[model samples]
Target chain A: MKEIWTITRRELQAYFDSLMAYILLILFLGFSGFFTWIYGSDIFFVKQANLQVFFSIAYWTLFFFIPALTMRLLSEENRSGTIELLLTKPISEWQVIVAKFLAALLLIVAALALTTPYYITVSSLGNIDNGAVFSGYLALILVSGMYIAIGLFTSSITNNQIVAYLLALSIGIFFQIIFQMLSSNLTGIAGGVTDYLSINSHFESMTRGVIDSRDLIYFLSVIVLGLVFSESMLMKKRSV
Target chain B: MDIVIENMTKTYGRQKAVDNISLQVKTGEILGFLGPNGAGKTTTMKAITSFLIPDSGKIFIGNISVNDNPQEAKKNIGYLPENNPLYEDMPVIDYLQFCARIEGIAKDKINDKVREVIQTCGISREKHKKISELSKGYKQRVGLAQALIHDPEVLILDEPTTGLDPNQIIEIRELIKKIGKEKTVILSSHILAEVEATCDRIVIIKKGKIVADGTVEELRSQAQGNETLKVTIEDGGLDEIFKALQLLNTVELVDFVDKSTQTFQVKSKPGQSSRRDVFNLCVEKGWTLTQLTFIETRLEDIFYELTLDN
Candidate 1:
């Protein structure tokens, strides 16, 4: 646990040092804040004190941002050959993968935290669904975690950061919208399976103040599977 | 701690990176690993550090089997891999601290450990600078510092001084020798002189297999099985000296080296010395023996002979 935290702290420091975290924060807050308050179907247009606009905007923003943040997590190490130095240390491959996941997740959480004033402003404006806002943030975090895991897996498979980013997006598209679109066009068991596989079904339910165990299971399983695959890819360096 | 490898083999596809190699490095020994490129020196070191798992066979670091408990075994090893890769964006101090933390040094002690390592590696003045900002010599120092942060019992450095100035190379070599006093150090280098200067034992590999293992003198004697001498006789004719030298019991063959200078090259019988015999023959014949130099086989010849293809 301490080893994971140490590595996570270094990775977080790297993000800030490289100015990636600050740029990501500004862009995320700018896009999400702009669309949620002043743009189409914004809060004033809806004439409601709810943050559904912010939550929806954040969902799409995070999907794009998380991969960018995670693209260099393992790829840079692989490119610079630092992975050899890192793996020779006392920590296991799983710990390194988990540490990278936590670092990106923490940065995402920081970005989400910066928008708390949105909640404050909405609550001050009128009656706000506090429970919905909390669940909405939870949904965004779960989605970010899932995408970060996929990004890490892609980074592990290649030493090129751009390749990692593109591969992650290609894989993430299915969970974000392709599966949902496929489900709508198909029928019967196939449609049902696609519907379950789509992230929107779970994310939308959570955004509406619902936290089912099944939804949590879906998000957690994807995160775990992605991390496991990344760890295996790292281990492949030894034998292959 | 002592390191023991038993018939370790690692293969990449059909090519065996390490082929049934076994070695033992005792505590307080500096074993120099010498080999041609792609001869499995790095692979063997990686296996010892628990970075590369062998296809078959076992490695034990003080009785801790690397395959069975790699994390435990890795704690006792400090490896400077080929090219000495590091986080170039991190400052020297921060990188060392990161290494110290990963090494599980206590929080309060981390700073002290980093400082000590920086001092030991002679990078104290540039500790605040980013690794990428440092020169190649300083960068190499940072690599050594991170490895020595935990003061592990075993140190595996692959080509530790590849791109350094001569002064820096000597400094690094001296530092390694100082550290090897209480630790098992395995350093790989293509520079024969550096290995001869620092290492206690040398292991030369070819085609993923160990071909030679011993001290400098041992390898020299092994290759220098027959004694050779270059003798210059002042008074006698070259042919007469050659024939007279050949008549000595210990002399195997004699050939004129330079007829104008009356110099002859003499080869002694296996495991025999002809210097004394040649001197007595010159004395009896009243011929002046101006120069009689023993020709020793060099390490380069031995390495070339062992590593070159048959």
Candidate 2:
């Protein structure tokens, strides 16, 4: 546990020390803000108190920004050969994976927190359901956690940052988009399984102002599975 | 207090990186691991450090089996890999402190241990600088400092002095010698002189197997079963001198260069010094004796002979 904390702190500090974090924040906030104020007003004709616009904009923004945030997490370590140093430490492989996961999760959480002004703005406009807004934030966290997990897993597979980014982006898009398309093609239990695997379906269900245990389980499973795969990859490499 | 490897092997696809190799290092001894490129030096070090698992056989650090309990075996080892990977953004001292924490040093003693190692590694002045900002030598020193922060019983360094200037190399060499006095050290290098200077006993590996393992003098004696005798004769015919020395039973090969200002190289039987025989030969040939020197076979010659294609 102590080793995890040590690695987490260093990773967090590294994010802030570089310009990547600031640039990601600006890009994310700028796009989210632009879509919410201008595009939201134009699309709905009369956007009084709806956060639907903000959620839509934020999700699309995260689709690209999260990959940029996580491309270097494990890839840079591999490139610099620091992975050997890290493995030689008196820490388990799971600790390293979990620490890096949490660090990336924290960066996304911080970026999401900066969007709080949109919440306050919507609340002041009209009779916006605070419950829906709160649930939407929860959904965002869960979805972002899943994305970060996938990004970390992709980062583990290669040493090139560009390759890591593209892999993460493709996997992210598949889970968020392609799985949703496949869910509709089947019926009954198989369709249910496909829907459960689709990240957008669960997140969309949660954002509709209801907290379902099934959605929580699906997202958590994805996070756990991604991390386990990363740990196993590291173990396999060390054995060879 | 000792590390024992029995028939350890690691094969990658069709190539054997570390073929069945066994060796031992006693406590508080510096064992130099010398091998040419692709001779399994790094593989052996990685296996010993528990960074890589061997395909067969066993490695025991004290009583813990490395293959069975890698984490336990790693606890007793402090490894400095060839690249010295470090977090470049963190300050030197901060990185060392992190290493100390991960090594499970007591919280109260972490700072003191970091300070001590920084001083011992001669990087006290660069402690506050970011690791990326430090020079290569200082960065290497920081790497060494982090490795020593936990004070493990055994130290494994893979090419620690590589890519350093001559002065820096000497300083790091001396530091390793000092540290080896208190811990078992397994240092790998391709340079025989560096090994001879720092290691108490040397193990030379070729083609993933132990070819020669002994002290400098022992390996030299084993490689060249002959002694080299250098004879310098003053202003005499080299052909006549060679003929006279070639007649001696102790001399196996004699090559005299230059007819005037005669200098001759003579090879004699093992454990034999033919200085007296050469002196008598020179006197008989009426050659004025100016200088006579005997050269012992060096570790370089032994290393080349063992690794070179016969």
Number of the top-ranking candidate, with DockQ as the measure: 1
lDDT by residue for model 1 over B1-310, one digit each (tens)? Answer: 9989999988888998889999999999999999999999999998888888888999999989999999999999999999989999999999999999999999999988988998899998898999999999999999999999998999999999999999999999999999999999999999999999999999999989999999999999998899999999988776777788889999998988888989888999998899999999999999998999999898899999999999
Q: How many backbone clashes does candidate 1 have?
A: 0
Docking class of 1: high
Model 2 bad stretches (over 4 Å): A41-50, A125-130, A185-191, B283-286
Worst 10 residues of 1 chain B by lDDT: B235-244
Query: Per-residue lDDT for A93-178 in model 1, tens only?
Result: 99999999999999999999999999999999999988999999999999999999999999999999999999999999999999
Which regions of candidate 1 are displaced past 4 Å? B256-262, B284-286
Q: Where's the lowest-lDDT run of ten residues in candidate 2 chain A?
A: A39-48
Residue A24 C-alpha lDDT in model 1: 100
Please give the distance, in angstroms, between residue A145's alpha carbon in candidate 1 and its true position after superposition. 0.3
